[model samples]
Target chain A: MTTFVDIQDVTHVYARAEDGAPAVQNLNLTVREDEFAAIVGPSGCGKSTLMKLATGLQFPREGTVIVGGREVGAPVKLAGMAFQNPTMLPWRTTLDNILLPLEIVEPHRSRLRKHKAEYVAKAECLLAQVGLKGQGHKFPWQLSGGMQQRASLCRALIHEPKLLMLDEPFGALDTFTREELWCVMRDLHAAQKVTIILVTHDLREAAFLADRIFCMSARPGRIVAEREVEFPRPRDLEITYSAPFASLVQELRGHIAQARAAA
Target chain B: MTTKRHLHLAPWIFTLGFFLAWEIICRVLKVSTFVLPAPSTIAQAIWEYRNQLAFHAMHTLWMTLAGFGIAVAFGLLLGMALGASRLINAGTYPLLVGFNSIPKVAVVPILVFWFGVGWVPPVMTAFLISFFPIVVNVATGIATVEPEMEDVLRALGASKRDIVFKVGVPRAMPYFFGSLKVAITLAYVGSVIGEQNASNVGIGNLLTRASAAFEVPLVWAALVVLAVLGVVMYVITALIERSMTGWAQRSDMAAA
Candidate 1:
């Protein structure tokens, strides 16, 4: 498969207030088309920073990040993102929040007014896909944490971006809700075949969803280990209880533990 | 339904009780009405000079509203500019703080001297007094929107304008309204204070004239009118806030 996103040896550093060390150094990654990839690490391991770099929210200090065969210079509109908090605007209905990127990003921006009804239908459809069909008029605060995250995922997909970046998107939900959303997201990735770069601490989540998991060392984060899950397509919760899935999760956990100890 | 009915009459019952207690205490103690007239005396004075008080109140109300409108306009524009630019905030913050600390009421006399006995001085005073809260609140609101949310928007390839209009402004609404409630009251106070010093007609001027003649009851009557006006304005602003934030409030209630 062709690489959809390619990053050379990239380095990122935050200017320390009291002259502390760098944040991340010499990071390199490539996500192939329709690949479900996960970056797993301990807290503050720069996994989130890697997601930012991948999505073009930030540029590397020393290397290039190329998405779809072009170097990323500014923020990219060709990707969607969701985070732990969901962070949907309180004033807007769920449908409106989902349609936000379409109203803002080009090709659709100029056509939004002319096709508002159609766009709203699309947003509603995405909401329905995420099991939020009748709740489109509800505001962010009206929904539970899990429901909000589901809506957020719908919002991310509404623009039909080729890449979806999730930063701890399930972290705030309870175990049950999180597992449910994991299935929802898995079904989504299966149906759409969109390239996904999920940053998560849950090794089980990574093992269940990702085709490949990249474990990172602590900040200045570097990819310390890469593991490929040879699971077949259309994975379900049953796979999480299987022997191979447990072993893979345990291995990833070991890598994270080793990374934490080394840091 | 019970809560609704209770809410309606609760304040009135307390007010009536308060006035009754005050009237009884003064009358029973044989306290002179000169210092603090019985509520009935103040009410009577208000009835007697209804026309004069109304005219003066109109003056104060017009000045307050006009100044408040101007202050909101300038505050929003300046705040948007500053909020959109970190460099501007750094540059203008100290200057704003310096200007804010200059005892704005003390400058009222100078403003009157500059603009003379007209609406301009009071209007300017109201603007000066009300502008800061709006600017600070709006800027803070815009600044404090979740950074991760902003990153998400930016990643989705939203323009700067989109980011401001969709994320920054809507996020700032609660903060802006909070400041606006406070600003409206301050605007009224500013207009009244300015009128006291400079105007020929206004609630503030009425109070000044009554004080000059030592017509204490009449002064209290004008104060009562002013308080009522302030309350009416506050209630109206609150209604506006409720309407605008209905979605957010309902959502919060549901979540809670």
Candidate 2:
């Protein structure tokens, strides 16, 4: 498989006077073009920092971040991002919120005013894909948390980005809703074939969704282990209950425990 | 719906009840008209001098609006400038606070010297006094744009101008409207101060002349008119707030 994103010997420090936290140190990882990967570690172990570096939101102090074929000096425009919180603009309706990226990103930005109706239709299609049919007029606060999370996911993919970065997108959701969204994410990955990097702390989540899991050590965080999941595509929620899935989760848990102890 | 109507009418009922209570207390206590004129006398003075009172009140009303208009224009632009740059904010905020500290009443004399004591002083005074709230509110709105929101927008290649127009400005609308409810009243105070200290026209001038002549009833009448004018302007602002930024208000605020 071709390497899509490659991080090389990256070390980063946050604001010294304020946080004074060394977020990541000497981290190296590679995500292939066909991979669905998860970066899981203890809290404050710089999983988020790793994601930020990959997306070019935060530049590494000592190493290079390469996406596709270019070095990242600014925000990587080809990536789609969804965070733990939806952070939907309060003034906008769901449809307008979903259409926000198109209004900013170029090529689409240039064509948006000319083909306004087409874009509106496309946004509606996305809303429908997330099972929010005809509810586009509702504001963010009016919707349930799960619905809002779904809308956020729709927003992330609306630009048809090559790389999807999910920073615990389903972390706040209830267990059933979380599982439901896992299926939704699974279907999306199977259909779109986009490279996904999910940053999470849930061992079961990492074991179930990712084709490969990269376990990270404590801050200053570094990669300690990499485990390949042998699960087949279009994996259902049922696999989460099987013996193999439990063992996979245990193995990831073991690495994380070691990471916590080593810190 | 009926409850909503009752909610709306509660304040009006309270105001009328307050006036009635004042009238009864003054009559029962046989308060001197010189010190505390009864509400009936005040009402009679208002009716007897309706033409004069209306003329002065209208003069004050238009000047307040004019001054407030200048303030809105200046404040919004300055606020945008300040909000956009940290260097400008650091440089100007302390200066603004100092300016806001000085009494506009003291400035009226300086303004009169420059503008010859006509409509100019009142308008400028109102502009000066009412300008700060808008600047502070708008600047804060721009400054406080959520970091996550900015991060997402930046990831999507949104320009600073795009983020400001689409998110920052809109986020500040509730604040701008909140400030207007205060600034409008301050604008009126500035206009009256300008009139009392310098101008030849307006309710402030009328009140001054009435007091100098010991026309206590007329002074009281002017005071009543001024209060009503302030209330009317405040209600207008609240209405605009409801229409423009109803989304920003909490359910409790909407109910209140």
Which number leads on DockQ? 1
lDDT of every model, 2 decimals: 0.87, 0.89
Q: Which candidate tops lDDT?
A: 2
Give model 2's TM-score versus the native structure: 0.97
Q: Pull out the clashing pairs in model 1.
A: A23-A220
* Candidate 1 chain A least-lDDT 10 residues: A14-23
**Across residues A1-263, which tens digit of lDDT does each residue of candidate 1 receive?**
99998988999875542555556788888889999999999899888778888888777888889998899998878899989988898888888888888877789989999999999888887788888888998878778888999999998888888999999999988999999998999989987869999999888999988999999998889889988888997887998898878888788888999999998
Candidate 2 structure quality by residue, lDDT tens digits, B185-247: 999999988888788999988988999999999999999999899999999999999888877
Backbone clashes under 3 angstroms, per model: 1, 0
Off by over 4 Å in 2: A16-21, B1-6
Whole-model lDDT, candidate 1? Answer: 0.87
Q: Is the docking of candidate 2 incorrect, acceptable, medium or high quality?
A: medium
